[model samples]
Target: MSVSTPMLVTFVVYILGMVLIGFIAWRSTKSFDDYILGGRSLGSVVTALSAGASDMSGWLLMGLPGAIFLSGISESWIAIGLIIGAWLNWRIVAGRLRVQTEHHDNALTLPDFFSSRFEDNSKLLRVISAVVILIFFTIYCASGVVAGARLFESTFGMDYQTALWAGAAATILYTLVGGFLAVSWTDTVQASLMIFALILTPIIVIVAVGGLDDSLAVIRAKSLENLDMLKGLNFVAVISLLGWGLGYFGQPHILARFMAADSHHTIRSARRIGMIWMILCLGGAVAVGFFGIAYFENHPDQAAGVSQNGERIFIELARILFNPWIAGILLSAILAAVMSTLSCQLLVCSSALTEDLYKGFLRKNASQKELVWVGRLMVLVIALIAIALAANPENRVLGLVSYAWAGFGAAFGPVVLFGVCWKRMTRNGALAGMVIGALTVLLWKDYGYAELYEIIPGFAFASIAIVVFSLLGRGPSEAAQQRFAAAEAQYQSK
Candidate 1:
């Protein structure tokens, strides 16, 4: 199973292109601010595409499709939930967060925003929130590593450990050198590649497997339930699927896009573009999995490769449907998805370590140059940890993603929403919510609450804790209320 010369060239070029973008961003990055948030200067298109790319991650290409391929249309509900959640996040959180983060002491990171918003002079909120971010994001980053390893293992016949390191190397290199701007720019390119491959491959697959009606006939002959979207969808299942949207409010990588947009005015256009891209790409992913049934039915030999690994549907389709050169580019889309999300996660983790832990506690007066290098060092450390975690071949991309997504959605989502919307939200309540929500997710999953997603219980408990704690406390400070009012006014005027 030697790699084709064309595919090797295509992959090398794609990886080099990413490194080149990092170099370009490196020249413009003058300070720690630029390294972390691109100096908050991204335009609407970059903001929208970067957010979408980071949010979707390898899960969009690998996990969702695999779920559909393995189970049925019931899995598509996750996509539906995500679309709703993303829309709500954009409409409710994006512009307000953009304004609030700036007004709240010009905070640059999520923990920074939390500590500033709560007026926590003792930095309790910052430390707790930063710790939560590190715990969940490490698991999240491992998902991306596993995804990358899977691609190399299946496509080029590499073993797991070698492929894991190979897949992680480029992302680590570029992210260490360039930081936020590099991630955002590469995300834009990767988003376009992802959408292109998703769109093109689905249409070609449908045509190759006869028309829609014919494909449906073939699918029905094998298993009628595969096309039944409501076959096993219960109330709990529906709620769990929709709960994916809750993760949007708390995802550091995606929220960074909102905070970095050049202005609040760009949010409208970004929302429209981002939603359209999400819907189309999600539909394309479903189509790939659904049509894959028919294609594999007709060619049982190729199906054997995917017998236990339905996640490889996209890869197998590309290999079988296109010529070697074109297949290489399509496969590169998978790499793009993996790198786009991995780089964002690593950068976010680095920012937490450097800004919250290192700068806030240890070196409050550190120079910008010194802070930037520390941030880069943190990236290398986190990447090594994630690579170690992903070295286990039993790791499934979706399983790791699910656990981390629930952790963030429950722990941070309610608190973030209340901080921006409810002026009564005290720092005590924010801290309580963060701690309780995270602990609930951990306990729920550890105790085998697999009947429903952890986000449902975690989000509910966290939201309740916030309300109860805020009522018991003295409430937000006068200064905090004033900042909230200012942010709301800006939102209304816009």
Candidate 2:
């Protein structure tokens, strides 16, 4: 797959722009807060789009479309589940987390928030929470790398090993240079590019397939399941699909966006904008996969090539439907999706290492400048670890995402929910829930029922653990209760 001159130029230009943004962000980043959470200064628009972009990742362009391509509308249950989950996460968690993190001793990280919320002088909660973050985020970051490699491999015809490193090089450079602000700023731009590609590609594909009515006729004739939203959906399948929503509540990357917003009041505006963008983008992704059936039916030559790796449907559609110049831009959107999420994940991992481990334990008196440099070093280390994990050529973007999603959802989701909403949540109960939830995900994924998504079982067990242990053991201190009440009151009164 020789890269055309236009494609090479456009792609190079896009990568350079991201690098420039990193340099700009690096100049503005002054404190550890700015390096980790953008100093909680992001406005509504940047906050909303950055969250959306980081949340979607390459799965939006590659994994979701691939699922739809192979399984039809039945696969859309995942998107439907994510939409509902994201809405509830914003409505319930967004405003409170923003206010709570600030009120809880100016907590800058999730582990810090939990430690402060629980009043754990022992710092056990901080250690445990950070460990879980590192474990799951490494896998989560690897998934993004694999997705990027897939794009380069399919689009540029680069070999898998070379493509893997090439795809991650720009993201690591920007993240290492700029830190959190760079991730957020780049995310906003990437979100725009993602929506443009997702929206425009589907519209053109639908037209090429003849029309909405004609496309539907062809899809239905080809495979009724492709159009049938409810075909073969059982109780287990529905719960497993919808359980994806549970994962959002605990995803450190998405929650970081809420914590970084300028103010709690800004959440209302961000929520509306974010949800609207999510719905349109998700609809477009699904449309691309569904519409591809008709497009490929007419062009059997392309269809024959993509049959084995249906995940390439979006890439193939962009290649076949547009001129080289426009296709280059559209394909760059895929890279944008990959880099946006990958950079954010690396930054979060860096924060856990620097803040939770280094500053909190190794050198409590470390200066801000020292910690910032430490974070930059950790980002490179973690990105390299993820690159190694992603070197495998057989990894499916959606498969890796589902596993890591389940890990976080089951491990931290229950703890985060009860920690914020329940005044009685204790450090002991929190520990039990965190351990039980994380272990449940691993054990269930490996040995428990393969038919159900691990999140359902992991979440249920962890939530039950919190309730049972909190009742059986000691409750939160008066200080913890008052803080919880204060945080709850801020949102409830509004």
Tell me the TM-score of each prediction against the true structure: 0.97, 0.96
Tens digit of lDDT per residue, candidate 2, span 1-494? 45477888888999999999999999999999999998999999999999999998888998899889888988999999999999999998899899889889999899999888888899998998899888878888888888888777777779999999989999999999999999999999999999999999999998998899998898888877787777788889888898899898899999999999999999999999999999999999999998998889777887865698888888889888899999999999889988999999999999999999899999999998998999999999999998888887565543555678888887788888887778887888888898898888888866999889998999999999999998998777777778888878886775
Q: Rate the local accuracy (lDDT) of all candidates.
A: 0.89, 0.89
lDDT of model number 2: 0.89
Q: Where does candidate 1 stray beyond 4 Å?
A: 1-3, 395-401, 446-449
Candidate 1 total steric clashes? 0
Predictions: Cα RMSD each: 1.8, 1.9
Model 1: per-residue Cα lDDT over 223-283, one tens digit each: 9899787878888878888888888888888889999998899998999999999999999
Residue pairs with clashing backbones, model 1: none
Alpha carbon deviation, residue 101, candidate 1 (Å): 0.3
